[model samples]
Structure formats: C-alpha cells, structure tokens
Target: MGKWMRSAIQRQKQFYIQQLMQSGLVNDHERLEQWTMAELRREYERFNPAYNAEGGSRHGQTSPRTGEAHH
Candidate 1:
C-alpha cells in the first residue's frame, strides 16, 4: 500500500522534473546557480535512486548517497 503510493508519487515527480529540465527555461544550464538548480536536483535525488550530478548510478550508491547499500 504505502510502497505503491510512493512509487506513483516518485514517477510523477520524475516526470515534472524532466519537463522542467527539457523546457529550456534555464539559460546556460551547465552553469545553473547552486540555490535554484541545485535544490531542484536535490529534490529529484530524493525519489530517484540512480541520479547523480554526472548522471546515472555511481558505485551502487543511492541518488542521494544515503549509504543504504543499494543493489
């Protein structure tokens, strides 16, 4: 029950974040400010297990690197 709900919410958040990223509203995305862009990325990392500043999984760590020992 809780797991399913969380999964749905995570999916929705991922979709919205993707849309924002692809919207091109942020000029010079490569150099986005730490506050705005970084915060958003942090929120994303909360629900995305495989996210990283450089993208994708790294050393089997969680997106937030919570040290939970992801498989």
Candidate 2:
C-alpha cells in the first residue's frame, strides 16, 4: 500500500511537470540543460505524447501539419 501511494504521487508529479513542459513554461537551451534526466524524460514524453519520434503517425509529431517547413 505504501509503495502504491508513493508511485501514485510520483506519477502525479510527473504528470504536472509534463503539462508544464507541453505548455511551454520551460523553454530555451539553458532551461533544458538545467533539467535532470527524469525531468527531461517527462518533458519529452509530454512533447511526444504518442511516443512516436519518427515521421510516422499523425499524432506525436511536433511539426506543422502543412507540408511547408518553417525556416
């Protein structure tokens, strides 16, 4: 029970951190460099919510849907 509770709390914290990252609360190279591996993982998870880094599915792709690539 204790383990489960701890896990739940950790999950909740991760969720909020992901939300912040997705919302652009944390941006720029400096901020990225300051984050720990776990925090970066959570941020990446949020950015790539569908876990698809490749140009495959419609989801998880951060680029614009339009074919034109921004400079």
Best by lDDT: 2
Question: Which ranges in model 1 have alpha carbons more than 4 Å from their true place?
Answer: 27-71
In model 2, the worst 10-residue window by lDDT is 62-71
TM-score attained by model 1? 0.35
Q: How would you encode candidate 1's per-residue C-alpha lDDT over 1-71 as one tens digit per residue?
A: 69999898666655545644564433343333233445556545544544544565444544342335443
> Model 1: number of clashes?
0
Candidate 2: regions farther than 4 A off: 28-71
Q: What are the Cα lDDT values of the candidates?
A: 0.48, 0.51
lDDT of 2 by residue, 1-71 (tens): 69999898667665655565566745454555555556555445535545545633444433322233222
The C-alpha TM-scores of every prediction are: 0.35, 0.37
Model 2: which residue pairs collide? none
lDDT, residue 28, candidate 1:
43
